[model samples]
Target: MVDVEFRVVSDRRDGLLLALGQTVIAAGFTLLRQRMVNSEEGVVLTMVVRGPENGLLLLEERLGTHHLVNSFEASPVDASVANAVSAPAAAAPAPAPAARSNGGAPKPASDDAATAMDTRRVEALLPQLARDYPNIFIQLLALEHDLPPAQREATLRYVGQRVGTWVYKRDFSLGGHLALADAVRHIALPAMRQLVQAELQDDTLRIKNSPFCHRGEHGSSCHFLRGMLGGLLGGPHGTEGLRVVESHCRNTGAEACCFEFHA
Candidate 1:
């Protein structure tokens, strides 16, 4: 059995984690063991990955592609953990028609169709958002709460985030619902949740020992465990604001999604 390992220290307590599961998803890798430790220097992350070498390379590319690695001081992964993380999640790719938690499934998008619109969905969503409202989408991403399951794909399919209007060329990926939710919900999220909650519960531990909770944190740090939503929007950083607005735009485009905000 091929295995790979990485012991990484980040100056930021939780760098790359926001995008870690997402990275695993985009590269189609399976997460084995993931632990984050808070030390004097910063956050220390250890991950076990199992997948094809090509797939692993793909993930490395995304680490750079998504700015996840730059979020911290990432070192080259040891071969064992690298091999482990590179192995595919399933012997076969999850057959299309990915299921929704509600026992529903989306019609399999055709192979010819773009997976997440080759990043164009983000390309379109954020610039238009800048055109309409600046600092909103990024602020929304800062919220721990994600777009509700019902609206996640649709909303993500229409939006993006970038540094500036003309600089909209750099956009956060507005895709990966099927992969992110599934990967974390089953494999990664459980442990990540435990680690964060343990830190929060230990009142003796302050600041340095705490995981950074997004915006106005509720009872839970992990969104899926107890959910990350906060009281129908209208809180600091508007943690639940995006989800509240996204509800009306089910399967709609950005213009339609945005108009609902004003209308």
Candidate 2:
């Protein structure tokens, strides 16, 4: 048997270890040691196991495609590494450095500033958002006012992606993978209804009275919505190369905001 170590990053801790344990057993591995810790990246789970050398590929594939796994790294275990497993878990990996723009300057704050919403903060607010769904616009408007005009949409989009991914993990990560249209209908539409009036027809999602986009205005206010849809539908288990495009916006003379999902 060969020993391998896996480090997994996920948005939530609940059921993650259990699910992973099952996957490991099914992949013909014997769990040797594991560790989990809270971090800015969400939950980091490190596991060491022993299995047939040939099973490494299958194990990696399963972990990579797991809906709960945002990212993971696997490496063969060695003597020094195995010794370290007895020590306290190391800190979660630091987040990747922000991408630099032209001239080696950092991107705009809105593009790469600290995430607008982290997993913990979103988890804390979800119940309240569900309870007072209609009043969420007030909070959203407040969030808009706090951001610079140049940064508003980008910041909102970042928050949208975070929240969207969280919602998918919490609600839709179970059962099995879903196709683009089914996910849009079964996952996106219902999740959106909590915050906006949305209907799915064909491959387009129509939104009425978006809190962010006011009638008669001529600007894009659906950046957050676009980001949310992207997060919900663009993961490994979801549809790959899925794009959410806002074809029409109420602010731009449309009766509603029409977001087209192209897979």
Winner by lDDT: 2
lDDT of each: 0.34, 0.69
The runs of at least 3 residues in candidate 2 whose Cα sits more than 4 Å from the true structure, single-residue gaps closed, are 1-135, 215-217
- Across 1-263, the per-residue lDDT of candidate 2 in tens digits comes to 88888999999886677678667766877665677899998899998877789989999999999999999998889846665652333342222222466766323334343444333433343343334333344434544544556666666665566556656776788947887888888899988987777998787899986766762225778877887787777756588787788999888778999998887
TM-scores of the candidates are 0.31, 0.50
Specify the poorest-scoring 10-residue window by lDDT in model 1.
254-263
Candidate 1 per-residue lDDT over residues 61-135, each given as its tens digit:
665455434343334456665644433334322211222335353322233222433333333233333332322
Give the Cα error of residue 126 in candidate 1, in Å.
Answer: 34
lDDT score for candidate 2 against the true structure: 0.69
Supply candidate 1's per-residue lDDT for 6: 46
